[model samples]
Target chain A: MKHLDRREFLATSAAGIGAAALAGSFPALASAADAPSFRPEKDAKLDLLRWTAFVPSDQTIWDENTKKFTAATGVPVSIQSLAWGDIAPKAALAAQVGSGPDIIMGWNDDPFVYPDKLVDMTDLVDNMGKAHGGWYDNARSYCYDQDVKRWVSLPVGCTGNAVNYRKSWVKEAGFGEFPKDLDGMLKLARVLKKNGHPTGFALGHAVGDANSWTHWILWAYGGKQANPDNSIAINSAETVNALEYARQLSETMIEGVAGWDDSSNNKAFAGGRIGMTMNGISIWYNGKKDTPDIFPDFANVTPPMGPVKTHTVSNNFTSAFVFKYSKFPNAAKEYLRFMLDKPQADRWVTEMKGYVTPALKAYAELPIWTSDPNITPYRDALASAKYDGYNGKPGKAAAQALDEYVIVDMFADVCVNKMAAKDAVRKAETRLQTIYKRA
Target chain B: MTSRSPLLARLDSPRVLGYLLITPAAIILLGLLAYPLLLGIWLSLTNATIGKPGEFVGLQNYATIFADPIFRGAALFSIFYTVCAEFGKLILGLALALLLNQQFRGYRASRALMLLPWVAPTVLSALAWLWLLDPQFSAISWLLIRLHLIHSNIDFLGSGWGARFSLIVVNIWRGLPYFAIGYLAGLQSISKDLYEAAAIDGADGWQAFRRITWPLLLPITTILVAFSSIFTLTDFQLIWTITHGGPTDATQVFTTLAYQRAISGGQLGEGAAIAVSPIVFMVVLAVFVVRSVREK
Candidate 1:
């Protein structure tokens, strides 16, 4: 080779190296080219407030990804995790005060509550949707603002809810597999109770567990909290039917479940006090990590079909929204984009081990779903799930209904108080009407 | 001494000095107590949610909440909880205080140990009670079962009445130490001569307690009750930790309901209304306490 000038030699070497790297990993390079949704601001440091992770790996993997983002973009980030229930109040207070964490990972319809205070993520979301397999329907319902026609938040993954049961106990109850219909499941519950292996579901003000199962039961029976026209519809015959079904189901469950909180079922199931309960992957994951004998004997299945169709709800449906007050909105958006990118998103979903179902559709093809039979059912949670305040908008009214435990109380009224189903429906309708009417 | 400036001389006046002396306290009261209380009242009068600067809607929030059965239920429960808890704390606390007032071994140690429940963080103690009240694994339930007193687990938090009772019991447990220690202080100040005189006049133990101990202790008891009633009426932590106002809202109180509505439900105005509704009752109690103190 000829002896080139210093500038010429450096230029030639840089071009050759770049070409080789791109060719060797073309897809990675292509994704990298599309990575930054916005340029990082000068001296950008970010603070993110997120709910404490239910799965330990979720926190670890998220922190690792966050560190990688900082390394790549030279933007520092601090993460603050609080109990899941606390995120809503803190986020609301942050919005009210116009200062706090630059970004908040909020649950359910949190973005809806303060859409005006959030930085619009429509551009990032639309681009991500097209690059990925598009957003899940429930994700849009949660993060999109119809009035403003903007994406107020980026949809994070959801914690899927499934019926975690002891396989041996279910088999002993004369069911080879978990029942797949409402009637069959109720029959199994009765049999399990008789066999001294009672079933349980939260009937108290368990913000997550109670709301998940109660909403599913109501929807499965074709009862809607509000009609699509946004009219109150919870006092219908369908609601009464749902109430009756819930009361029957509660009868076969272990006593005192009516007062159970979010952690109660996990404790009860892990200790073998109950044969089955409706919950997320935590119980099974805990058993797998801590109790080998229990882990092998446990199994999970999607909730049984109801009269209308098979319906369920996830315990956690979260979204990340950047606050308008954030001085580094670009950096915040970029961080979310980096996290949701295929490489990181795929890694997150895989490592989560079915604890979190992906919000984007592309990751549904990840091998993690097929790697374990138990993990497979969670993949469909977002697809099968309906957003809160279904039929109507999952807006402030519905959020109020959910937080007030309206649906849970409706079922509990009949099951625990021995109130007539009609009475329970009427009470719930009055409460819902009060909430929705105000809205 | 050198002649002072007119401003300094004026400031030395009693009224000026009184105002000057109280300025810091007034500022503290305004910043800490008055501001929040006023803001809460103002918010209750408006239709404020979380993010929006809401429009004033007068008593619309109050109207809405008053019409709500849940609010009505909470109001009733708050009173029931306060009355029951105060009564239980008073009886048990007075008994313990009377016993502690006697000259005994480990008197100082026992007095300090009595403060454990009160001094420990409420959340931590409530959590301990939560474990004890667990429907399935409750140590209390297990003991009762082992003794063949019951066939099945007692769902301490599962039933409406059971949850209500459990909450009251926990409240009493935590607050008893405060009442006992307070009454003990009053008991120590009482002249032994009164008891001695009553005994010489043919009074029994109960008679001496009714005549001498009762009259002198009334002021402190009233003050203690006033403080505790407010604390008990507005309690959130122990109940939230234990039941979270569950079993069909049997244990719902104003604070929890307000939290559920305002913060969790995002209806700040309605929540503020629920929160401030109890102010009327609290004011009456405050006035009564002040009058009692003055009379004493």
Candidate 2:
């Protein structure tokens, strides 16, 4: 830290030279150019960069409702389907290069990680708060910096981990109800393995899995990363227990569990190699629609209780960001506000089925969502889920530590039998402190 | 400046044309290499960002990297990987070159086939290896299983050792062909009369190769080894596609670490520092190699 002075001297000298050049040109360009102000292209024309899995067709839709969304919303979602994992880096890169999707559908942590790189919607939040009948308060808070007083993103959807089971398999295993505790769950797991039902999990080195496993166990032990102060406090007895239990679970984990990333796990759950795993309603929704026979008799419920409480990591709570470069701040906010409206959100969830459960109360409270079995638990889990540390603008170092480094290498190190639970946590903690300090 | 006169005129005739010929390369190098190098050195002393240019922070970035465990691990791992890769490429490539230089059946076809690995784009080769290393669908794993060479399938990219081993093998495979071709070309350029003269003096094939061929090829080897060291030191794709420097810091090279630090960590200054650290050594090694080869 002490070295900053000398470095600042040399750097500032050069920056001053560059700044002179930039200042000389920028004001001239701004004044002469036509971009003094321009509104976003908001003609009720919504643009969505959909995930690859969400794009369905050519297989014949058995449901008539989806056909109607296409027909009615002639807003015909210019659906560009990208692999979900590719969304962040691609979006981040595009945002860096100054041309990205008007509306990119991604996972939860993006808004926090890319907040400054996004549009602030305080006015939109106000207008849409009333416009959308006041979105679920928790969802709204997750999408913004409540303390900073800005709506960094609009909560479009929500996802949460749950006890997804092959209802038929559990019935045959002589289990009447889902496992309520760790011991019961292990006993059932053993019975299932003995009966030739192999449990599989996808612990791939992806950001989704990073959050997924953290939430799976953190909530399992009734622990949270943030205290009331929102500081990292994950290292605790409960977290350690979850770590040990996660390792033990790794032993009984099937032969090819490591090979299967997100897709493989979805396939395992659907194809019957795995009876029950913790996942979002999207797993079931995707399965039921794509591979109907593999869907099986299903159920979604709370995950097993640790000594603390039974909770699942809340998911699907994505925050929408407006980049600082957006020519139309009002229009961008307007577009986000439109997505917040109950009818639009309801139509989205209703059409997409249970994949993206809406975060807006107006949308969640709709009769369509209230009646859906798969989406209901997402609503319930939102009450207790914890968020990782990204203050709406996730940095590269923090991003690497969380997404590329920590989860795959550390958590999976224990989860896949490479290292002891305690050692992995210790190693990760040491590395994390250094990385976080730099941040 | 006027000392040479007419003698310098003839040499200077080609000099003007040579500069013209190399001008494009110089410009490209300046933009891609020189500018980036200067930019990195500049940024390492500051907190320059993608979205915002931050205030300068001096040598703190370098100090922070030294203090950090992950950076240390990655740095150490990079040295290990580079050493292993360079040795593997040299030894295996030389042995293959020796074998291929022999008079054999389909000699031209065999010689032509050696160029395949060197010619393939790195990204494609890495992608292919990813498939072959796939635990579930790995053709190699399937063959190994059938031959009873192993137990169940191994997750080549899942464990630290497995991931590192996979990268080394892929790099060796890609590196060997180029090495062999370079050696083979060097072999062809050598005068056959030396070998004949040695044979007339009662030298066997081994002695002829050792005394004559190896000595003459020293120049080539010096150049080859140094060039490969530079290439291997900065390699980003092979490690990226194979392990992404993963399963931990096992396969993380300096270049990959620099990228992860910059783009993913958003510590552009730190990343720039890490990226440029290699240049100090790289420049020294390159100079040494050029001088050593020239002297030979």
Candidate 3:
């Protein structure tokens, strides 16, 4: 109230603000005893690196949820978004340099690729599992390392892939409804091709679509990359059969499936050029937004069953890793905790338009799945979904093999290059041996 | 003003001043170029992956890559891509330069417009090309199909030949301007008196171009081709954006293969080995360029 000089005024204001901030934090400090196990360090700051979601709305929801976390807890957060393909290399480089985001989101087997550099998030995993129903088997297999006896990552959700098709076209292709099995699907695809609405899936080096579908086909035909002992098992009769099946299917596909990437099929399906393709729900979500006319014509079904099994691979398993070098491990865990909290999780599911399939079973009941019947198949497909490494654990070797596009290339050799299935399998076997033989 | 200081006198020397002027550039080159180059060479000798500190494995990575079929395929593709793209660019650029060299209306504007493909960022233009060559809804495919020139849509980036052809066409498109502008400068520098003298000597257009223009432009062409070859061989963005060295590794080049091995595959050592393999060819080309430019 007295007449004060400029320096006096500034000093007084600074002290007052500092006191108010300290006072504001007193409740949090006092409630330490009642604090959640994963509470962040006092005044922690965090950096999170994740891939840019295919659905812009999904990213928006993620941003909003992070903002909610920052509002609830005073910890400011910075999010770095990268292209999906760039995420692994960026995360790996960061891990190599030992200087990067506090938390990094990557696909399956990413944590295993740099297990020594990632923090053991066992407590965080146990807490999330206990809080939300329980961890899905696939998620547990992806996150947990038996050798180290620790969870190096927290499995969030998978970007579910299903058969995205033009239902009207399917009906016109001499099929009253979407094909329910592999044989029927192939027959429908042939008819669609004959009618100039060919079904297509990537046969090239698409990390997501091509890899996922190729693996599904391989497993469906009882083909496996390696045995349980990690011995080479790629060159089998089952693998040959799978390749033969894929080659026949490729004959019915668009001319360029051999060179298509993950987005090609999505673009084809959305632009009304292709009859059916395997893709994440974002394709439909995108069609609904940008191409409303084409959107209603689109429908989805669970990936069809093969003779041996009804399994498919989910390429979009979003897993988060807190590096050992992070200055705010507690904060990273706390953020995940807040994100996975039931109410927040439900809102996220709705906001993402069910693009993200829950890793926790309880979140399956979120009304978003039932909101659109087309999206329900994605939820149902979650039951048979497998990560990149199917019969074996998702390890460093699996990550390397997937990144090299070995499986994708193996199929392309048969379908695109006209290599005999036996020869292609032999080549893939040698490549797999080279990859898995390394320590 | 009265007596010069020793330090100032020494600094004022032409040699010292020249070194002083270049010190910043030297430092930048050492830091940005030399250091990384040396680091890459060192990394190639080690068994580096993502996080762990790699131990030296001598020439093991090189040996492994040398034995790899993919590496061999990529090497062959890189050579083919470079030679074909450079040859196409040279021919098209020369034609453009010859046409532009003639006195014509709006020549300046035409010259400026030619730079759009070259001046635009490679990634942006490549994305545009991606849309143009899209297998399903390609504008070019639509045009071709409409004309009944082809039975169905040409899979521009689908098959081995299609992807290779698309890559080369895009490369030529992007690189034509550089060659044209470079050759235009060379063309303008040529004395008009030489053409007049050739005409007086009864040399026809082809003879004049062959005798006068060819000899005069040889040095420039040699340098341009060498440099362009290096650029085309090491090109990553254009190919990475277009095909990602796909269609069964049909379009794989050294740079894309290096990226796949080092970054995507996380075999940093092998990736570096793949990357370093291109240096031998580039070094020979560099020598040729330097020798040609130095010869008067």
Tell how far residue A89 is off in model 2, in angstroms.
Answer: 3.6
Tell me candidate 3's interface RMSD.
1.3
Using DockQ, rank the candidates from best to worst.
1, 3, 2
Q: Rank the candidates by TM-score, best first.
A: 1, 3, 2
Q: Which candidate tops DockQ? A: 1
Supply the global lDDT for candidate 3.
0.83
Q: Model 3 residue A178 lDDT?
A: 82
Q: Write the per-residue lDDT of candidate 1 for residues A29-55, one digit (tens) a residue.
A: 234434334666779899999999888
lDDT (tens digit, per residue) of candidate 3 on A1-439:
1111325433543554466467773222222212144546667899999998777777787887788677656789999999988888888888888999999988877788788898888877876787677877878768887667789999888888888888888888778888777888899999999999988889877878888789888988888887777787888898898899998998888878887877899888877778989988888888878899778898988888887756565556888999888888877887877777775677788888778888888888888889888989877656787766566656877778887788999999998889999999999988888888764
TM-score of chain A of 1: 0.93
List clashing residue pairs in candidate 3. none
Query: Tens digits of per-residue lDDT for model 1 on B1-296?
Result: 99899999999899999999999999999999999999999999999989876989999998888888889999999999998999899999999999998878899899899999999999999999999999999999899889999988899999999999999999999999999999999999999899889989999998998888988899898889999999999999999999999978899999999998888877889899999999998888788777865786
Please, what are the lDDT tens digits per residue for candidate 2 over residues B1-296? 65777755665788876887899999999999899778879988987655556788989888988777767777777767777887899888888888888889898899898888889999899878877886566789889999999887777766667777778788889898878988888888888898889989999988998898888888888878888888888999887765666655666778988877776655678888888888776787688767866786
- What's the DockQ for every one of the candidates? 0.79, 0.20, 0.64
What are the clashing pairs of model 1?
none
Candidate 2 at residue A163, lDDT? Answer: 69
What candidate 1 gets wrong by more than 4 Å, as runs, is A1-31, A34-36, B287-296
